[model samples]
Target: MNRKPSTIPVPVLMMIGIVAISFSSIFIKWSAAPASIQGMYRLLFTSLLMLPFARPYSGALFALRKKDWIMLIASGIMLALHFLLWMGSLKFTSVASSTMIMALEPVFIMLGAYFLFKEKTAVSALLGMGIAIAGVIFIGWGDIGISANNLKGDILSIGGTAAVAVHMLIGQKVVVRMPSYLYSLIVFISASFVFAIYNLLMGIPFFDYPPREWGIFMLLAVVPTVFGHILFNWLLQFVSATTVSMNILGEPVGASILAYLLLGEQLTGLQWTGSLLVMCGLAAYLYAGRKKGKDIAPVLDNAS
Candidate 1:
């Protein structure tokens, strides 16, 4: 698959994608609804917006090989769980802690590769993972650190991060076979159904959300889904995957800033230190990719 440079300036695309993805945590916080509901409407609206473009690739969706179907379904499930778990964490934890926990993602990806794909990490990367985890412990353990609720949020955030990493892994397996938009469309719609089923089983009301809630839902769809993950995925052909992956490190910083300005949230000293440590460790882990000649593949946006 021969790929050309993006017609748009790559830095401009990077800024747009980073700023867009960063708002995902803020959007989730803006909503008063369940995470499943927010994810449902976000992905559903995303699917609708893609319908115009999807017509061309709709056939490929059906023509997927059996392995592709399995991969797509598993990818969809992981994506759904990622949102459901991660967004829920925001209710109980500070945006700083939650996003800092997401910084553990590269660690999860490395571990996943070791177990699932038999990939090995160098000692340097392993030490980096340890530093990052210790940082997250500080983040999650701020003043009143032993609060069970905060711990629950931290756990949920970790689960969410791991889920999305698996989503990316499964996506790595099948994405090359078809167009990205088509694969995304199939996965998003599948995730929508997962939320739908969950809502039904949990007896959560649907379609009764107020107008502002509806607006937030659409914002989640457009801001993060379209402008964030979709744009980041598209940018892969034009830039190094490491370039794109590194921009994701901005989420903890960006989201924390947004949280302070919009949500009146302030990070404790420990949280600030943890946030810095997380970035340093994850940055080190990602650069190790250079030595191995393998960057993390394009990832699904978890903050989204």
Candidate 2:
């Protein structure tokens, strides 16, 4: 007799994804490769690793309707663009600033849901988001400045955040119909293709990287790209896009702590305070979400 497969709880999976993605910044910082180059290999390797697993779902992929195909391809392009812009932002701005700015993804997602889906948001959730945004501002207060280059980086990060928000919102609709692994495989493959073309256009060499850099690339693929992002894609089937994006706000806190421990980066008193506020606000938001009932209700409640 065949036994059934064991399933992990959604909350547990989300926590694991958060922890896994938190290391993405640290890995990027440790590598000496150019941002696009690092992003290219990371997606390329992730696609390769996912190939064997996705093969079983070949029929599912082939059965996709034209609309499904369009959404998947668009989502994949946005994902690639998000990585490119975010990685580029890291070159000119501090990690704290980049990550903090990227955390604005939820705001974009909320706005998209409102305009595209006619969704409303709860007042409590809005308050929580405000608190979290304030906390992120506090954490990055010192790093933000009026410099031209820094402003450019900030703009890039904001663009990346918008791209990713669009990706997730699309996934929220598509993933409900497609199997998680199959959906992720298609998106990853598409992103890898985009990255490959980008590398070729820029004349960036994919091979001949140092052994250490290759190792970092592999870690990024296996840990963050696969485990972290794929898990979020899977969770999108159960939760609203806004909820998933809000949870991602924890990345800066996790990345900051890792930077402190691994990279010897020091945090300020305000940063510490801000970290606590973020945690508290996130918890409040999630709690309010659960209490509201329905995956969409938390984000769809009237603002009042």
lDDT assessment of candidate 2: 0.71
Candidate 1 at 174: error in angstroms? 2.1
lDDT of 2 by residue, 21-60 (tens): 8888888888889888887788778778878777778888
The segments of candidate 1 whose C-alpha lies over 4 angstroms from its true place after superposition are 1-9, 143-146, 300-303
Which prediction has the highest TM-score against the true structure?
1
Residue 55 Cα positional deviation in candidate 1, in Å, after optimal superposition: 2.9
Estimate TM-scores for all models. 0.92, 0.79
- Give the candidate number with the greatest lDDT: 1
On residues 1-304, what C-alpha lDDT tens digit does candidate 1 reach at each position?
A: 4669777899898888878877888988989999999989988998899879878887777788998898898899999999899989988887878888986777888898899999889888887788898888877777356477877888899899999889877877788999877888889889899999999999999988899999999998898767887788788888777788887687788888888999998977887888888988888888887677787765543445
lDDT of each: 0.83, 0.71
